[model samples]
Target: MTDLIKIMQQRQSCRSFSEKPVEAEKIVSCINAACLAPSACNTQPYHFYIAHAPEAVAVAAEYCKGEKVNKWVGEAKAFVLITQEHAEIPAANSEARKRDYRQYDIGLMIENFCLEATELGLGTCILGVFNEEKLKANFRIPSPKSIALVIAIGYPADSEIRKKHRKPLEEMITYLR
Candidate 1:
């Protein structure tokens, strides 16, 4: 397999994290990679709110602890809150508001961020179940912007990499050719 494939395989939704804190430089590198991802009409239409401080992490963790499985998010040392923004497509004599691509663009960026994090020997978990109102209120996020996802980042408590359970390629792919 190629290096990218190996990195992809290594990326997983980490639920358990160590007490070790994630480095600021590494997080910035990951963000830089995320920014390289392609977006609709070249409009990134997203912003990342990073909380690496202990207090900020704790506050963000509380909002992410929505369901039972996510309770362990408190262990993560850092959190990246993704917010969706209005995409202004500059089109000449064309309608640009027919469809929304903000979610797709955000997903691509998140994947790039997570993949870079995995390559940097860090663990990440993309969380969709969070207290949006509380997070917005506490973080001072404007009412117009919506929270897209929350990413928990840190070193894994467990050293061993678990096998990924996924559908087979044959079942997951369909070819017209």
Candidate 2:
């Protein structure tokens, strides 16, 4: 397997984090990696609002709560609100295949960020159970737009990357001849 494949297999959603702040330079580098991910016509329509300040991180964490599984997000030292803009590919490109392009683009950018963070020895968890409406209001975000994902990142305070249980290739794949 390739280095990227190894990285992908190693990445895990970290639930416990330490008080140690993620170095600013490393955070910037990871975000840069995300920006380099492919998008529709290179539209790069995703926006990442990073919250490193204690107060800001607190606010972001608040909106990420409301569920038992995500309560740990509050303890994270850094939070990123991943916002995706509505897709507006050029009119001439209207023939493009249908699907929510913005959502797909966001997924690529987020995986890039997580892979970079893992390579940097930082831990991350992609959070989706947050209250999007409240989160938007807290950030003064207008309604009707998409907030694709919220990610928690920091130094790990808990266990190492444990074994992941997954289906084997045969069960999940089909070889078409």
Candidate 3:
């Protein structure tokens, strides 16, 4: 149980990666874990595009490396593009609901990927500041599908997870009688 706690505590968004290449099996292992994340009504309305080769990864990174904030993306070894099947899932995208359950599902999936990556000694940085148009063009993403988030994964230059600060449980939660 301590090992799990350590992995949870140590997982951080890595901005820098080592020159050493990440094994394909490790990437697949993390993604396989991601595939098991729960979805809304079992819709599972999303897709993952993985870029592993240097040239392919670089191309994907270009879309996310917009300005100063996301410049760190260029250094990551791989980028996983998460796209939502919005048009196809019209029944779930109701504006009146004031909530996007699909987005919530996507978040769960991404977290699963991150946790698995951390467990396998890999690093991940989730990026949403990229140009969607460029992503669509670069990846040839079909219309009606939107790029929800991109995750950069690889071995970290510094394998240490920096200190994580969070509000105490009491501050963020309350029990009901």
Candidate 4:
């Protein structure tokens, strides 16, 4: 548990990235680690589209830029587009089928991905302010599939780990026991 906590502490949303390109193997490792995340009914309703080539990364970066958000993604050496896929039975045929678990699954996978990247000395920033339509069209994503998030990945220009702030556990959670 402490090991995981350390990784979490080291992981931060990096906005300043160096021009050095991220290794393909490192990206693959992140994806593989993400697949280890448990999903509802074993339905991993997500796909990661990697863009590392200069042209591809440029296009993805352009789509990720918003008026006042994610403008720093342009310097990332690679981008990963997390796309939401169809979840036939999100509840595993249980009675609580109304609640879709795809979003939760995606969140778990993304956390795993980020943790793995941090362990590998890479930096990542998750971006949610992208032009989904442009990304879908440019990346050849089929209709009905939606881009849930975009992650900028590369070596951090500043290697120092920043402090993380969060609500205390007593305020954020309650134990029924």
Candidate 5:
């Protein structure tokens, strides 16, 4: 199998992380990969902020709503906040279509970052249940965009916990003429 396929198969949402800190250069590489993701009309409106401070991670953990997430997020060595700006859509465009495409663009960027992190032997989890308003206030995100997602990064604590099960390809695939 190709390296990309191997990376995809091995990638999993890691909740337990070791105390080892991720290298700054590695994090930057992941973010660079994310920035190269394709976007609708090439309007890459996403912005990313990386927080490596322990105090900042603690603050973000407090604002996270998930109990399981709070336990793990608090220990993460770094946090990445992804945001997207609100753009005006042409009157001729369908609202649903515009929304769908923008969301797709965001998903692509997130996946790229995740895969890059995996390649770097780092663990990451995409978090959605965060207090957006509080994060903006605490993180001082300037106006023009809103949080899309947050990713917690660190080294996996245990290999067993890193193993992830996936649905069978046959079950997920739909063959159509």
Candidate 6:
């Protein structure tokens, strides 16, 4: 199998991490991959705030909903807070289109980021359960738009977790007559 295929297969949500720090270059590479993701009309409205500092991570932990899960997030060596600027979309676009487009674009960017991190032998988990208001206030996010997601990144701890099974192609695919 190709390296890409292997990376995809091996990718999993890692909740535990070692105390070791992830290199700056690797984080930049992951962000670069995110930037390369396809966006609606090339708007590229996403902005990422990397929180590797102990203080910032602590703030993130406070906003996180799950105690055990977020404690692990706090311990993570690195995290990226993905936010989108709603005003970045042109006024000419419909409100519905703008709302939907921003989310779709951010999701694409996150997937690209995770894939790149996996390829670099890093472990990551996309975290959604967080206090948005607190995060925005703590992070000084100027925009009134939604803070889409937060991804925790670090080296995985030793453990035996089973791979999540996926539906077979035969069950998911359909041929049009």
C-alpha lDDT (0 to 100) for residue 22 of candidate 3: 82
What are the clashing pairs of model 5?
none
Which lDDT values do the candidates have, in the order given?
0.92, 0.85, 0.82, 0.92, 0.81, 0.81
What's the TM-score of each model vs. the native?
0.95, 0.91, 0.87, 0.94, 0.84, 0.85
Worst 10 residues of 6 by lDDT: 87-96
Please report, as a residue range, the 10-residue window in candidate 3 with the lowest summed lDDT: 87-96
Mark the regions of model 6 whose C-alpha exceeds 4 Å error after superposition: 67-71, 87-99, 159-161
The superposed Cα distance between candidate 5 and the true structure at residue 110, in angstroms, equals 0.8
- Candidate 1 lDDT score at position 94: 54
The sequence of per-residue lDDT tens digits that candidate 6 reaches over residues 67-96 is 545656765778788888643556676664
Note the residue pairs that clash in candidate 4: none
Error of 3 at 7 (Å): 1.8
Error of 6 at 75 (Å): 2.7
> What is the Å distance of residue 29 in model 3 from its true position?
1.3
Cα miss at 15, model 1 (Å)? 1.2
Of the candidates numbered 2 and 5, which has the greater TM-score value? 2
Model 1 poorest ten-residue lDDT run: 89-98
Q: In candidate 6, how many Å is residue 64 off?
A: 1.9
lDDT of 5 by residue, 125-156 (tens): 89888888888899899855688899989998
lDDT at residue 44 of model 2 (Cα atoms): 85
Please provide, for model 3 over 55-163, each residue's C-alpha lDDT reduced to its tens digit, 9 standing for 90 to 100: 8788888878787788877778888888987524455556624555888889888888899999888899889788888888877898678999989987899856678
